[model samples]
Target: MAFPGERSQPRGTILIANPSADLYGSDRMALEAARGLVSLGWRVVVTCSVDGPLVPQLRAAGAEVVILDVPVVRKSMLSARGMLSLGRDVLTQLPRMRRLIKDEQPDVVLANTVTLPFWTLAARSCREAVVVYVHEAEAALSGLARTLLTAPLRLANGVIFNSETSRRVSGWPGLERRDRARVVPNGVGGPPETLAARERLDDMFHIVYVGRLSPRKGVDLVVRAAALLRDAGIEPHVELVGSVFPGYEWYEAELRELVDELGLAGHVRFAGFREVVWEEFAAADVAVVPSRLDESFGNVVIEALLSERPVVVADHTGLAEAASGFAAAVLVPPDDAEALALGLSRVHEEWTDYRRAARSDAPRARRLYGPESFHARLSQALAEQAFPVPSPSMKDASWSPREVLD
Candidate 1:
């Protein structure tokens, strides 16, 4: 079936540019969008900086994957030397981006993250409509840095914020002026069948945490919380189901040290990264997403809820939004281990009730975050941003950065 606004004939092509090929939160969302678009009769092309698991997944979803060295904004690039390097990259890559837009002649260019400012510039220079799918929200950045980072978003014909918090935190004044922005929560796919939370024969409570093992993600707090539970005479087995970024290996080491210091050697385990986490959620009595930093949206929260597992997440930003109104979710202050422990303790104390609530809420979570609901909302959002496709005669028109600058 064609999407609401899709024509009977194949809809025009869409080129999606993403920064990484890792199947992380944003990567998974991008893949979902590609799959939905392709199913709706749109030819999809996905571009990434490197090859990883997401490459094959995108291709499997019927997207043409292109490995390109796109200029992506990173925290390290704020330094003087890094800025110079970034400048050089932009100077060199911007032309290629413009050329790619010209060659693909897509109806819309969807830049998956706010990091790729040059993608918006290139698409505009090519006189093509561009939409930015914003998935990051760092409220801690200095005013100047935030402005500099988000300035390019003004050039986008449309902006798709992952959550209401993201749309608000973006601080772009023009977002509501021309109906240029829409908030579409990330669509998360759950297991084919809801795996009922297993009853533990032993007193040990299984707690699962998924996503990056970074400081900002507050993985250490989970360890501390585990220690707190132990101090309270509760046996909790905490499983961290993700790995850290290349430069952040030290964080994982520190987490291990903290686990040892807290004497949680047997209680806490780092399972590294997993492509599929349904089994982990299935076995988990409870899940925790204690992100200390701002998140645009929490896909893991929805995943846990859909898995019929009670979840404890930080009560701020998009995490709270994702967990809001869910009967099985427990929200605690960001970065507070004691509170996390307390929350988990409450779940343990009332395990039967919580488990029942989790099972009852699974259907609701599925209705809101399941693949069908997500695809429908996404289709409507994209259809709203549908700009008139350029005529075939105008497809060969030459455009350059100099013209855009002038």
Candidate 2:
């Protein structure tokens, strides 16, 4: 792959495989890493089982993209029919993937998420360096899922975790003992040059939530929380700025019904999938992340902080870890609409203070999770895996303020 800028001699070929092509957190990071590697003079080829919005971006970044008809294990595929379909997919994809691995002859095989552990097996047979970037925390996995995901890491050359919470919850003590695991927190694009003043929205306190509208994401709780605020005689404008997942359109309908049932129709707006979501974050008084699942890292939280907007996240899972240091952030109990409401109420009452604190602490998040830091760490991790070198700086800190800030 080559970009428009001056290119260098190829370092080595790399094959990056992801489960889905949607532009979600994991997929987004995968593209970022692929683009970074390309810029570093690596010939990159990206493969995924499905296709979506990220295909054009991958090509624009000068990475060759190939859509493969492989079977990926999903959480929704736990039923009888789904299991049968999965079995068929695995049987067909096994030999096909093995052949592709042999043909590519890549120096490194990068697996983006845990759902596609088959890449590890294929890379092992080809004697190529294998790196798995785990984006989900252990608390979110079932017993069988956890076994399937970690059993292959024992053979992996390197393991990259998105957050410290993901690293600890992964229960992979052997990776640490072998000096194979590294925590590379997710990074985001820099915020706009200028942001709208938060004080300008004094008349209507706008609350924004960004991500998929699924049960696990807890969008319903946001609706309930908005209703609770309405009952408390405060009518805050809540703007939801994301669409539902592939099979979860009903969840969006359900949330709308919930809003109507609670008489919050006028107070809530579902703004589906905006290209410039950061603008929404910059305009809001506060951002909310009420995930019921154990998130590995909340990228939206960082985006909000970079936009200088205070955040309120659920206490459970990696959400609490994502909002640890910011004085502007408030932690509320997971799956509790009342708790979320109270947290929002607090932000509403002390809006300016939280906004000021958010601005003061925003640079810390950017300095740590910026693109330079992410690409630098990623290059080092891959280089060490390809050729084991000894260096004192490889030692990870016992605690990093950035690790807790997602």
Please tell me which predicted candidate would have the highest TM-score against the true structure: 1
lDDT of 1 by residue, 1-406 (tens): 2332334547667899999999898999999999988887778999998889999999999999889998789976755576567878799888888888888877778999888888998898888778999998878887767776777888988899988888888847767988788888888898877778866526788999999999999999999999999999899999899999889999999999998998999999889899899988987899999999999899999999889999999999999999999999999989899999999999998888898999888888888887777777776666555533334774567543223222
The residue-by-residue lDDT of candidate 2 on 54-135, one tens digit each, is 8888988889998887777676774557666777768778788888878887767888877777788778876778898888
C-alpha local distance difference test of each model: 0.85, 0.80
Worst 10 residues of 1 by lDDT: 397-406
In model 2, the Cα lDDT at residue 121 comes to 79
Model 1 lDDT, residue 51, Cα: 88
Clashing pairs in 2: none
lDDT of 1: 0.85
Quote model 2's TM-score: 0.89
TM-score on alpha carbons, each prediction:
0.92, 0.89
Cα lDDT, model 1, residue 177: 81
What local lDDT score does residue 331 receive in model 2, on the 0 to 100 scale? 93
